[model samples]
Target: MVVAEIAEALDVRTWQLQEAKDQLSEVIETAQVRGPQMITRHGRPRAVLLSAEEYLAMTSDRPDFKEWLLGGPKANLALPESAFKATGEAKVEK
Candidate 1:
C-alpha cells in the first residue's frame, strides 16, 4: 500500500470573504480585532479567518469527554470496603 498527499489550500466558506491583504505581522492582529474574519473573492463568499489557537482547537481531535468519564465499564458496583466500614448509623458526635 502507498499513501500520498498533494499540497492543497484550505477552503473556508462564509457569506463573503475579502482577500487578505496585509503583512504577516498584521494578520494575527487583524483577526483578533475583527473577531473571526470573512473571506470573499470578487463578490461571493469563500472562507473565514481564525486565530491560530481557535483553528487548532477546532480542527484537532477532541476526546469524547463525557464518554471518557464513563469509558472503562458500567455495572452495578458497590463502594469500597473502607466506605462500608463507616456503618449504617452515624457516629454519635461527642
Candidate 2:
C-alpha cells in the first residue's frame, strides 16, 4: 500500500507526521513501538517508517520473480527482432 494509505490505516493525519531530519533512529524506534510513522514537512507527509524486517523484505531478492513473470500469461507474444537486439535473449520460452 502507498504511505498515504498506511497513514490512514494508522489514523494519523498526513500533516501530523514529524520531519525525518536526522532522527532515523528515533523514528525507527518510535515506529517499531508505535507502528509505522509518517515523516512530514510543510504539513505534508513525505516518507514512511518501516521496520528493519519490513525494509529487508521490501529490498530482498525475489528468488521466484523471474519464474513468476515467465510463467504468467502462459502464451507466446511475438516481438520484432529489434526488441531482442536491446533486451537480450529470453532464457525461457513460452
Candidate 3:
C-alpha cells in the first residue's frame, strides 16, 4: 500500500517523519522500487532515501577532488615578478 502519492513534477514521494517511522520497511521497499523517497519533518524536507543501486549510480562515475585537479588542462601562463613577492611580515630561517 502506498503511504503517499508521488509528486509527479519531481518524481519523488514525500512522507512525514512520523509516517515514515511508522512504516519504515514499506518506505525502504518503495525506495528500492521507486526512485527516491523524501522524508520531511514538520512539513519541511529533512532527508531522502535512495536504493543502493541509485546511490551507487549517482556517485560511482564522479572523480575525487585529487583526480579532478590532476585531470584539468595544463596552463603555461607567466606572471610578473611582483606576483611572487612575500606580502607577510614573517622571516624564514635556514
Residue 73 accuracy (lDDT) in model 3: 100
Candidates 2 and 3 compared: the better one by TM-score is: 3
Instruction: Give stretches of model 2 more than 4 Å off.
Output: 1-8, 12-19, 59-65, 76-94
User: lDDT tens string, model 2, 1-94?
Assistant: 7657867888653433444556666777776676656777665567677777777878877658788788678655777667776788764445
Task: Give a tens-digit lDDT track for model 1, residues 1-94.
Answer: 1111110122222233223654444555666665455555665445566888788878788668887777767776755555545776444433
Question: How does candidate 1 score on lDDT?
Answer: 0.52
Clashing pairs in 1: 12-47, 17-39, 17-40, 18-39, 18-40
Models 1 onward score TM values of 0.37, 0.49, 0.71
- TM-score, prediction 1: 0.37
The lDDT values for all models are: 0.52, 0.66, 0.82
By TM-score rank, best first, the candidates go: 3, 2, 1
Per-residue C-alpha lDDT of model 3 across residues 1-94, encoded as one tens digit per residue: 2334435556888989999999999999999998799998877778899999999999998999999999999997865455556554344334
Count of backbone collisions in candidate 3: 0
